[model samples]
Target: MKCFVAVLIIVTLATDAVSEASVRTCEPIKVAMCKNIGYNQTGMPNLARHTLQADADVTLQTFSPLVQYGCSSQLDLFLCTVYVPMCTDKVALPIGPCRGLCESVYERCYPVLSEFGFQWPAELDCSLFPAENNHEHMCMEGPGERTAPVGTVTLDSVNAGGRSACRRLIKPNSWVWVRGSSRCAQFCEAEVLWESGERRAAEVWLATWAALSFACTLAAVGAQLACGDRGSAGERALVLVALCRCAAAAGWGVRAAAGRTAAGCAKDSTTPTRMLLAHDGLANPNCAVVFLLLYYFGLAASVWWVVVAGAWRASVLRPSVTTSGTGTRNDRHSSLLQLAAWGVPAALAAAVLVTRDVDADELTGTCFVGNQSSKSLLALVIVPEAICLLLGTVFLATGLRAILRRPVPVPAPTALLTSPPQQITDQTLLRLGAFAALYAVPSTCILATWVYEYAWREDWLAAPVPTEIPSTQPRPAFWVFLFRIFASQILGVMVAVWIATPRLKALWRKIAGPRKPPLTKCPAGPPPTPLTLHCYATHSHSLSRSQMHKYATYRPPQQHSYRKPRHYHYSAGETIL
Candidate 1:
């Protein structure tokens, strides 16, 4: 019994000693773990490790059954190898041969871990690796450390031994890593990769609409010009509006084409990955400038043209106003309207060009006045457009109301007899109101959507993380964007339809040809009437009145005696004796 007790005590001591030794060795292993992942004395691996570990724990704790189980199995092996001296030392044997093996292990493990929402601690981040050796491998920097150049590091020149070592530990193509020099670059690349079929469909839709709008606007402009002297001031203003729409649509089409090229390049798997890394694939500055100029000009011009049309309509409707003898006034108004419609937008665009950095993207491939964050875009572009649209709408509404409510003059009874009374039907009022509403709808929709998006930015930003590969655009934003595209692009078509009125059609016909008057013929029954006979009396000498009377009396007496006997009657057409 004494011998057995002694044997048990000895076994207990041996087990305790082994555990103590392991505990002591794990301290160094922890420190070496940081170093193996490229952390140095300057790097606060403990802090990064703690923070990342907490995040990982939260992620794992909240994970679904399948993910939790799969991750648990993988992490068990990883944690065991990390904590145990024997396992760690076996992997790091012959440090030179194991260098690549260590890197390969980290590379292969990180993506799998990330898939489970486990971000490796910053200390283990390849970006934190020493700058001197950045070309040798991917690295992460310590907090406040100077950032190393990204994409400068490549594995192309790695020695055969290193490749062999890495291959022995990690399967071929098991992990592919890309390092960008800047976070912006990485974000840009991720955005390109994250682009889905929906966005592509949206682009195609926008492009098609833009093309149609361009054609329609061009046709409207031509038709309006063809009206020449017959076109009303309102029609002329609409022509300007249509021309602006054409310019804007053309710009959009061109911009979309550029974006399509970039998207095509991105979608091509055969394209070199290095080429895709640059910003050129996203936008071109030169093309952006042209697009922005045309787009903003058109946008501003359209708003101001509405203002001009409203004002002109109001002038024409006012009882006190007469267009007669107002040629100078009309010309001045036109000049001012032209200045406002074209000049203000030009000035604003110039200001944007000078004050802001314009950029283009696959989403809005025009050189718009802001970057991806769109920090000043609302203020610069959308706000002015909104204000103009609002003002124009107010002007339109006021003018239309004034025109509608104005008392029609009662015709005098005599005037009514001479000409029929001019009718103002309910249908005419309804049509006018509908036309005004149609003009306002597109701008109003655009402004409303923009406001909604702007106000709801926080909600959009705070939306819950998606379980699957997240979409680059939120569903709400995508729908809103699609709506805006449709509204803006369809304006030209609406205007074209609106201008196809009977009056314009009549004017077109008149311009084509003028009518001829009917031919007349004279009557044919006037040959029997010889109303007067011309007789020539020649006298050799002039006689006094008494002598002429005596001669007449004598001749008359002789003729009377003869005529009494004969009693001859002469027709009124013949000369009497």
Candidate 2:
């Protein structure tokens, strides 16, 4: 019996000695970079199983670039705590950072590292760690809770609401939201992956079209000025369309040249990340200016298209009996068109600014309204474009109907070659129709894209596809944006093409032609007079004087008398030249 008791005691002592031998000791840190890790001593072998501090310090050097990249504010701390864990003799094992900490740092910095062709280390699997610091299973919360005793709090739900709101505003397509950090950024903004070329292509495409559009519109406007065609109110309204297109297209280039850094992409922390939540207004100067240039001037371009079709001429054309009323009515109509064009766009842009709805497009890389929130897209872009298109279409149909139904004038044999008083042409009507259709098609396509964006925005966010995926197959939406980009440039090119009448081309040729060589000697006579017809009539004829200038039948006079070759009548007080 004594021998049995002795055997049992020996077994107990052996088990205790084995456990005591296995106990890990806290060792002083030798790593220079990890010195600030809350505690000086760490348990060995660490999460990486580096037995000595020197070994741990060496392995950690591999992650130096990620730490320096500054993706997460807590990256350095997380890395240090992971390699050289906090150790105390009071506990049997060392404690490492929580899974939450690892995940937060991993998500923020992974994309940055991936850009360099690095993969996340297998040893640092976040799923293997504890979720939070607690008595039952202790782990670090983060820097904020580094000094706190274990078993205290969890940061899981702290940022949930803010992150959710940001997700909605971003409406990420070829990008992802990293809300773990204080700032939520699009994944591609921080790191361009294998699909970097696609993003770059978008920027270049927009910039290319913008340059083309700008030149086209400028040529149209300059042609009007150079040809001396600005006198007609219809031509004046057409010029306004060209001017607005120029301004709007110029804004498109800003985003292309600057790429993702341009306006509508403000990342200031002082600003709210969510559009719907930001009633305080967008404080970004660039964002506001670009918004005004693109939306305000773009809408104005559409508005002026309506005026070009029906308003200007309808109000100004008179029966010649009441010519005095034309000026007052035309001026009033002009004011109303200006108000609808400039004032309405200004009001709408102001509303967008106040709501802070601006965001960058992934396909175009240009900052524009309604790209972020589908609600904003519906309210600001779709509605406005639809209304303008409708108004322009209605005006165009009525103008065409009136022109087609007009009574044909019976002409005197002498007046066979003379044009009727009305100046509306088949060519003019076609241009107006072209302009409206151009606006309508693009606007309709854009509305379709937004519809797709709206329908899929949430589903996409719920299960995000890897935005930087490398494959030839792309989403169907990509082609939709491509069409949109291509179509937008079409308007400017067509406008310039349509307005380049034969007369305009002749004027351009005259201006571009070599200048007449200076006269070798001073002319002894005044330059030949233009408007040989107008030289005799110092003033425009009044409508009441139409009968006075009508052609009369000619008769041969007596042999002694001289007969005028042309039977032209003169006003009562006019000089016969």
Worst 10 residues of 2 by lDDT: 271-280
Looking at model 1, the pairs that clash are 126-139, 126-140, 127-139, 127-140, 127-141, 128-139, 128-140, 128-141, 129-140, 150-181
Listed in order, each prediction's TM-score against the native is: 0.51, 0.53
Question: Global CA lDDT of candidate 1, please?
Answer: 0.49
What tens-digit string does per-residue lDDT give for candidate 2 at 1-577? 9999999999998786466448678888879888876778887888887888988888888776455334566777888888988888777666888998899878766765675467989878899789888888887778532222322211111232333323333232323233423223353243222246676676677788889999988887777777775444565777787788888888887655554554535443322332211111254556556667888888888778777766533632323424356556666677777887789888988887775566555444455676545567778887887777777677666655665677776767776454453344434545555665565676667657767766765444343334777534223356666667777676776677666564477696786996777879767887744432321323454323443354233444557733223323434344433
lDDT of 1 at 177: 26
lDDT of each: 0.49, 0.62
